[model samples]
Target chain A: MRQANLEEETAVLGFLEAMEKGLSMKVLSGGALGVVERDGIQFAVLTSQALLSLPQDLLAGAEAAGLPLGVLEGDGFHLDLQGAALVAVHTKAQTCRVTEQAAKLFLYGRNVLGDSVVWHEPGLKRGDACIVCNGRGESLGLGVVVGPFKGMREAVKPVQDLGTYLRDQDE
Target chain B: MTEPDFPVARFAAGPKIREWSRKHGFSDWMVARILQLTDRPADVLEGLLHRPPRYLRANPLRASVEEVLSRLEAKNFSLARNELDPNILKLRQAPISPGATIEHMQGLTTPQDLASASAPLALGAQPGDIVADLAAAPGVKTLHVAGDLAGGGLRERGAIIAVEPDADRMRALRFNLERCGATSVVMRNHTAQELPGKAWADRVLLDAPCTGEGTIPKDKNRRHGKPEEVTAMAALQRELVDAADRILKPGGTLVYATCTFAPEENEAQVSRLVGKGYRVEPLGFDRVASVPLVPGVTQWPGLELDPSVARARHFLPGVHPTLGFFVAKLTKRERAI
Candidate 1:
């Protein structure tokens, strides 16, 4: 693996901290990290081991530093979740809850349609990254807000599932 | 399309084979070799001309095989489960593009060929085993090993060292591995030959690059490859096999596979390994279920392969609904004290 310089490392740490906050959970450490840019899209790849072992204090410190973090609409930060405990510690107000059927579709990389959303945070708007949970409150993945919540059938047009990070069709 | 004539007597020298090649837009040389390799030349030609059903191996790391199948079926997508490997499903119909389906994008399923899925199955790396994929770029099989080593769970305990020499390919490989949710892999941007002998693995998979003759049906350019090019691939394959041998622990299994039908690259290469004290073993396809596989050829012009080479399996496009593939399983003999 190519080594990342100090700037790249800092950028990655900041991005990860932001993701942790977005998901409302702390990431463990003990894995490795690398950053690479391809075709104008930057990707931060964290090994599954690292994700499993990330310390909460380390992320807290990074957040405290107020590192400038920005994810362009087209860029991605990928984390290996194998063996990583993704506990949804935040309250229900912070999550977008979908039906059991919708949860299956969401995990399959489908956007969570408005009709499928059982509940959601009160103030979600377009392009807000929020945690997508199932009826049982398990974290399905992260979602990008595409439309505002209106009602049972009118709120949250479609939430982009986090699985899109792995959808590289270049091969 | 009208069916081609069957049982062409003297197919090796007959005009029928050439006529069939011209009719099917294949190189005459490839058709002639197919005729010589199998008695059912017509079937092989038909299989090549026809597009095989697309297969997807459900990523067990993300979802159960049953869950994936049920979701696809609920969406009205046509699918049939492989009895031998529960993870494999043949797509009979789809409401949307199979590759673009939500299941595919979510890493719940991967578009893979039936033959390509067999290499990992043949290796059968148990949980917590250290495995090495010598040529793992665009790592479909590497992901398979990772998923299997984890026992089809999100928690990965086993490790896989994926070695790909090409920089450009490594980029795509990393993308695929991430997409598939394969967290157990350690990507190394170096050739298999560079792996130190001390970094031994419990199992090694050498899906060596080859002339790709078997994929000609899917990739027409393979039909135009020169014979010398096949010889060149054989030379490289020998180097890769040597490296695999060096890094494989004693009594460890090594599965050598290729997407080509050239004897110089397949049987002859395995013969060389046997010469070096590697024992040929059954691919154990039957242990799973009945998959279409013909025995590896032992006799080819200018090459005398060991009889044990017959234990290896050859998956011809004609005999199986898959691209042409050859797989051989071998175990390195323990050295004497």
Candidate 2:
């Protein structure tokens, strides 16, 4: 639990900016950026620690209304379900909609097959972290793209999915 | 001639009450109280004897309602849309425990009954309002407030300061909030009575601890309660309500609720607040319109309360499928009496 460093912050901002050209670090509004490193993963979190205890006027307000952002993993940022929602709310994050079968499989933590892809937004290249949506355009989680789009083999490796929260929760 | 006296109401006490209580596997006090709570005592008692159906509230932040419902249907789950409460999905059947499903893991849906779900709606925290759940533990309602309602006010995320006194329950609270990916929730571990700071939150929710009489269908032990026990619980609830009023910003809304039907903890508590000049407000929502709820119990033989306490609503166990829950909303005064 520490404030994110300039280097770590820049890396995350760069990754998000590269993935979605319109998205900026402005989404982290009203929340302080912090890092919680566990199991060799530095998880980036947006929190209201700075403002929660103090009195807040309704007028002097800047709200970072939804979720704390990215889960910075091994090397690059692998935005988890919470993080994916953070970036996608206003402008869509780099995303791909998958079939119902693929969505179910993806939720089970499996890599999605190329055939499972219903459609994907352009500008996302191989190894880029992308938001995975079900056929109804509901996000399953973040996945790392592995080209080519039209193939019979694995196209995206799931780095984090929604089920991760259920599995990782404390009893 | 003997069966004609089966009019349970005509012979309310002694043998009649005892026989009804024994027949329903409830204590005499519980049976007698239920009889007084409603004219349809048989229906209420019968409702407590059986298992109730489960319902789910899909987190829109995670998935679209259409997608989540369609996906679950594919998994052999028989679900029906609850026409009464459009936001809830009634689980007709499930192949596995709904809690163990992948959709639950994805933070997509939660097993929230209609009554418990109504508290946050009653508070009506705007998207960016600073909301405090005074007794937040195993944070089911906190998750709803922060995720689905104004707490998630997705653009300018409002904040939730969740306070749970017990460490073990706080762990469970933390788990539910994380499981739902509910954002900007600040969790504190301590009793609300001694919680530091004041007048910080724009809205406060004290879903206080109660006798849990409404849970008889799920856990039968709650069907028996002593009057002294309710009085003891009321003392603690009053303390928590005081804490809620202390921290809530002037002009903020405070929703004090419980999952029980006890007047000692329900109307009596609200009547105390109104005695202190707290302006009681209606739980302004159409969601509760279809719930078979009656006005808050204003009088309980020798214990008459302020008529304003009637603004509180009780979702009766017999009349409503959900727990016999009680909810009251009030607007804080600029200066306390």
Candidate 3:
């Protein structure tokens, strides 16, 4: 969870730096602090909702524009910038399953251009769900990218008894 | 709007907010109360409350800041330094029992209000001089200046007199002083004005008690209080600053700081000091200008002070990403023999 927030913060800082340089872009997906774009570079902001929710086309376009992309892998994620890039992902948790489509696009783009990319993977754990796919089915295999939206959120015990929740599997 | 009776419940309902509240070790109810008072977007509040607490660099004269932080981080705790006080830190990872920590118990680290740290940092204490931390309960800035003076060998001639009005807090100050290994400090427990040793020092730090309007982040009750209550505190602040001028030696520096946003307590108090023939010194606004100096109060609405009143420093968390505070630096001109 913390790693997700940091990525969001770094992305926002980059976006603001870009904006200060006179780039005009509207936030396409996510809330107030989401990524904005000028010509085609997709950038993220600290307060915006996660980029995983972005439309597939925009995410791919952002990748092509030389825009830095933060890909959520297992528990943590990877941050790709122009000259200098470092990855900060959770090492404790297992990698989340990424959609085959996202996996191909993310890896291919990096491999083809192959700029200097610094990978930081931290605090990864197993059994984490993909932020985009939400673990309904295996849309994406585990450990494709790095960042949050893959960490575990255990169910909190009930503070108040709203009666008992009947299990679907139980008779 | 009147405060809700059930603040704790409100805080626990939201996952992000609850996480932050827990991280800071704030009571479930206190967390809820703070969130209710803010006009900020939900995410911002989460960031402010749950994001890592800022770390404070302890003045070596006061305590072992680096060592303390390392130990705490080992316990899964994190903190951030206050933007204003190089010595004051906000805890990001709430300690199960922060006060009981060896460093805290040893007075090596103090859990101070972020706004409280701003006042002294704005004062900008220098080496080779006498300094006073008036209203120096819990001695956060006193320790800050001590740490700065460490290894400089400036204290051979200079002394730091940390004066607290309350007896309990004065003891707290002493404990911190001992833990930080600051030996050159003198602890006095008396209302600043009533203390017999007036103007005996070269520099004075008055961290006056105010209505604490700016302390809502730490003390949520401040928001629900009446404005007149604050006004009353402002009146008292003026009296304290007036007394501060009397105690500071001519050519000595005096820093007036408060954790409240009330102009009456901030700019107005500084204006009163400037009127006393103290040459107002400008406090630095850039990031590198660390140390506890007051950022003068010159530009807020309803202030009738001089246009050149740059001696005061005003800090609002909303503006500076920290707590709300006001500070001003003034140098008492040398009196003719």
- Best to worst by lDDT, what's the order? 2, 1, 3
Regions of candidate 2 where Cα sits further than 4 Å from its true position: A1-8, A18-43, A47-66, A71-78, A84-160, A168-171, B1-13, B62-85, B92-103, B147-153, B179-181, B224-228, B285-292, B301-304
Q: lDDT tens string, model 1, A1-171? A: 223356665555555555445432233233344433435544344444432232332222110111011222323333322211133433454468888788767766676778788787777777766677777565667667776554444444334443444443433
List the candidates ranked by TM-score, beginning with the highest. 2, 1, 3
Tens-digit per-residue lDDT, B1-337, candidate 1: 1211121112253588677767767767667766677877778888777667778888887788888988899889888887557788888988887666656655688878888888998999887787889999788898888888877556466567778888878877766776566656666677888776543688999999988988877887776766667667877888898889988888899999999888788888899899999999998784223545878888777776899999988778866777888899999888777
lDDT score for candidate 2 against the true structure = 0.72
**lDDT (Cα, tens digit) per residue for candidate 2, span B1-337:** 0111011122246797798777767768756776677877777877778766778987765666677788789889988776444557878889998877767876778888878887887887677677888998878788777764433343326677778888778767766776666656766667887666788888999999988888888898876777666667877887888888888888889999998877777787788778766888988753343555678877675455899887888777657766667899998778655
A1-171: candidate 2 lDDT, tens digit per residue: 455678777777787787656465565645566665544656676665543334433212111222456667655775666667556564555889899888878887899988889888877779876888887566778898997677788889998887665565532
Query: Judged by TM-score relative to the true structure, which candidate is superior, 1 or 3?
Result: 1
Q: What is the TM-score of chain A in candidate 2?
A: 0.69
* Candidate 2 lDDT for residue A24: 56
Q: For residues B257-305, what per-residue lDDT tens digits would candidate 3 score against the true structure?
A: 7776555566666666667777777765543224333334454545566
Q: State residue B64's C-alpha deviation in candidate 3, in Å.
A: 5.5
- lDDT of all the models against the reference? 0.68, 0.72, 0.47
**Interface RMSD for all numbered candidates:** 10.6, 7.2, 27.9
